[model samples]
Target: MQEINSIYPTDKKECYKLILAQLKSLLEDEPYVIPNLSNTSALLNGALTDINWVGFYLLHNNELLLGPFQGKTACVHIPIGKGVCGTAVQKDAIQLVKDVHEFPGHIACDSASRSEIVIPIHYNGQIVGVLDIDSPFIARFDSVDQEGLSELVNILEIACDWANVR
Candidate 1:
């Protein structure tokens, strides 16, 4: 097992680079989806600062179902086009909200979450799930976050065994 530092780099870009490297090391040769996602969530939660939630919401039966996560209790199901996670799936793009309260149709799983970023996860050319992260501070996520998290999701898209997951 590879070990990671609890301390995260101050630079957002470098932090994501390190986190992505750690993810690659963690997911290598791991064919299982649940465990891989579980570790991935935990890794993000640990590596990131000022984030209250980190997890995956997988698509199933035309709806988003809760998957592995590291945070307080969260909503179990969300319809496509509904909440941040659902919106990412519906639009097939990233939803980086500076203020959740300002977002139309925002779902507050945690009232403490003021900002959020949701990245759609695709596998085999099909939308499979989303990587959702939430922060307590408003405007916590910016363009740098959008790019970094998007790249992180890209790593997950390639690392996981989507055939078994879907």
Candidate 2:
């Protein structure tokens, strides 16, 4: 996997769109893992600003365990209703937190994360994981990001729904 630490002149929305397109191109059959897109964590971390961590925490055993990420070590376990990711799962919705500190029962996976966005990913009609993104700046993910990211993940779930593992 490649590691990207910075963003160039490429447009954020367009870049992410292209990225999603590329990920779609790599799709195979059901329950298949995204081999080339495995490193998306790094790309997202670099492309977006004020973000210290970018990745997912899969739902397993009724808990959210850390998955692939591009940042420092993070908390491995988070129960539903514990943190942003948990809340997203519990509500089956997307959470855009401006300040992690102000969020009740916030899990300090990374002390540097001030803002966060968690989008639930469903597989075979079941909540399987979340597309989590964090930022150091407050209110980093706005409506544009929320809508775009949500739509992007939706496309992923539809095309790659057969298998969104890893």
Candidate 3:
């Protein structure tokens, strides 16, 4: 296989670049739903750099259930307003935690995840799921990531335009 060049010379910027590109490809002609979840999880886990957890928690019936994922075993479910991913959906905003330990009501899905960025997936004016990424280093995420991932969600939102994200 051919090795790919880093989108950014530094690790952080490359992470966003790879994620954005792969998501664009994955959702290209692909509708957002159960069929795409598996590939999305794999693409997230494999394409991104330095991530300990790359997966999704789908919003269904007012609760979050563990969807396709790549990492250690994670929480099976989270209430709409609970934990990092859940709260993101509940609040309909992105949560970029510099340090999960310092954040109030943060759930330690994996002790190794010191930092996290969770973006709410919106559909038809409602939150339906979250794109959650985790890293083992504190302050691994920043505002740039928040903005980049938010754009990612928009792209995905359009791809899955017919599905109910919530």
The whole-model lDDT of each prediction reads 0.91, 0.74, 0.78
lDDT of 2 by residue, 44-156 (tens): 66666667888878877889887777788888998988889999999999999988899998988778789999999887777878889888888888887887678767766
What is the alpha-carbon lDDT of model 2 when measured against the actual structure? 0.74
Per-residue CA lDDT of model 1 for 81-127, tens digit only, reads 99888889999989999999999999999999999999999998999
In candidate 3, how many Å is residue 43 off?
2.1
Better TM-score candidate (1, 3): 1
Give the Cα RMSD of candidate 2.
3.4
TM-score of each: 0.94, 0.82, 0.84
RMSD of 3: 2.6
List the RMSD of every prediction in angstroms.
2.6, 3.4, 2.6
Give the Å error, residue 61, model 3: 1.9
lDDT, candidate 3, 64-93, per-residue tens: 988878899999889877888878987787
Q: Give the TM-score of candidate 1.
A: 0.94
Ranked by TM-score, the better of candidates 2 and 3 is: 3
Runs of candidate 2 exceeding 4 Å displacement: 1-11, 26-31, 34-37, 159-166
Which parts of model 1 are misplaced by more than 4 Å? 1-6
Each model's total of backbone clashes = 0, 4, 2
